[model samples]
Target: MTSSSPLHILVIEDNPDLAANVCDFLEAKGHAVDVAGDGLTGLHLAVTQNYDAIVLDIVLPGMDGLTLCRKFREEAMRTTPVLMLTARDALDDRVAGLECGADDYVLKPFALRELEARLKALVRRASSAVTPSVLRVGDLEYDPALIRVRRGTRTITLPPIPLKLLETLMRAAPRVVRREELERAVWGDAPPDSDALRAHLHVVRAAIDGAGEPPLIHTLRGVGYRMMAPDAL
Candidate 1:
């Protein structure tokens, strides 16, 4: 799989063998996987961490998948796509999963290939709808086509480099955009210098996070940068 094709996934399954097989298959596909053996732990990770998609089991310890999915959607206010796994083939069971916000469902003993394909579809759907004509995160708004950037009622102006960086960050808002990814988006393989991203990001921070406005651009030090409203933090 290409670097861009790899998705970070969360696997919430109590069955050790099934979990291992699923994890191995997904990892072999160049995806990152995180495993949670119980519902409570799964819910914790689901809320606190970020994942491209989730594979959840219906029957779980501590909390059932239905309750977990409901809490994730209602309480946590997350829109991450969830593909539920269950041994039950009943129509009501499947409906329950969907009613609780699961995007897709798979009966247990499913093919690993099928599982991955479903996840890919879910991620594709989410990514497709992620960006709108006017991208807004908190009070920050960016219109890529119009080349307009604003923080609340205040209009902001930035240099070309910083504007490009801002667009990249806003497009991946609330998700950490790695330093390498930022460099590629703006300057491709030929970034002027090692410190070029840092310098440009500094400018972006200053342009959008002026006084009276809540800071939106955050540096992750060794990791990367993420632009999110304070509530998301």
Candidate 2:
């Protein structure tokens, strides 16, 4: 079955020929594709960017698919579906792939049409699953889909930068988000000068924790930031 809308996909394969074929096929089917030749680069892109699904090769340079998938789930806390590609058809390999967080598996030398269908199915299932529509830290609530932020009964207006900062912080509430992680999430690979994050953070802090409100956002000097109810501190 063909996808109803375009999907943004990442292909993490070390083989030049296979990577090119998969990318070309997916693009021809109206999907946006990003390629990473090795596992390190793949993990970086997977964590920093939003993707509908990922096509990962089991064996990769720098790091293997299983390790990257585990880190993506455990360290990054992302729920993106992963469909692993491997030449091995052994039951142990399949089980290992699943145990490491792959949602589906495809043996290499497989049909291109089948690969596309599997990727589409994974995206469909993930999209249909229920997830928290809004993210919150104490009184601060962010509706990402609606592009709205509210603190208690007050509707907070924020510029794009501050809004992104707020959402990132809220998503990782009660857990300190590293400054570099914040920068990458907002600006991707081309982060501006170091002071840019500090300036935008000030904006977020002021807008989110106004007068008389127990400050929800906290900064750890030389470290990073986190958002949580004051009582939890």
Candidate 3:
């Protein structure tokens, strides 16, 4: 799988030893690697460069991994595939990481094989073809291709992950999209807990509904979500 166009990887870890070790391993596997010792630097590199994948550590000096991921999406408008590395194995931590836009997670003290496998999977998914370009519900329209969302004549700019989530919801508009289904669509098979789905939904809601329209993404409390015009309900 090592080709002339080697995969570019960014390792964002505060621990110099761990970062160097991971970089050495990935480099040995015929990949190009860059290391960032702090969250802020890592975020800057991630946004500025076009990396095939990112290995992100949860704990850092300036900013945490979760906050860094959110900031990258919200501020920098980055959409790189992220693999979160953390010692905290709690479900909540996992959910928080994924909700903030990480694509995969590996617990600390993990084997190199597991980390490599997760990295390959994340990159593979990221390289796959995305959903269609545009989605519509009632009079509102969202273009995943252009990354511009429109309600009536007004256009809104949404971050990448939220736009993807909104596209998934709008594709199944007027129908109840199960929580697990949405998770699979956005985060793949190894998604975090259900709370992560809710968190992303909250972000999406703020983007769509904050503009003075009825809520199109509705929760069924326990079942799932439905995209319907406010007037319809």
Number of the top TM-score candidate = 3
126-145, model 1: which lDDT tens digit per residue? 55422347888998888866
2 or 3, greater by lDDT: 2
TM-score: which is higher, 1 or 3? 3
lDDT of 1 at 146: 61
Q: Which candidate is the best by lDDT?
A: 1
lDDT of 3 by residue, 1-233 (tens): 33244688999998888888888888988889999999889988999999988899999988999999999877887787788898886666876776687766677887776677667766665565665557788778976655578888877654445666788889888899998889888667766544556655666776678777777778898798889987777
Per-residue lDDT over 1-233 for candidate 2, one digit per residue giving the tens place of the 0 to 100 score = 23588889999999999999999998998999999999999999999999999999989999999999889987997878798898986666765666566766777788898888777766765554223479977777888776678889988755445666787888888999999999887666656445556656766776778657899988888898988887888
**Candidate 3 global CA lDDT score:** 0.77
Q: How many backbone clashes does candidate 3 have?
A: 0
lDDT of each: 0.81, 0.80, 0.77
What's model 3's lDDT at 178?
90
* Cα TM-score per model: 0.55, 0.55, 0.70
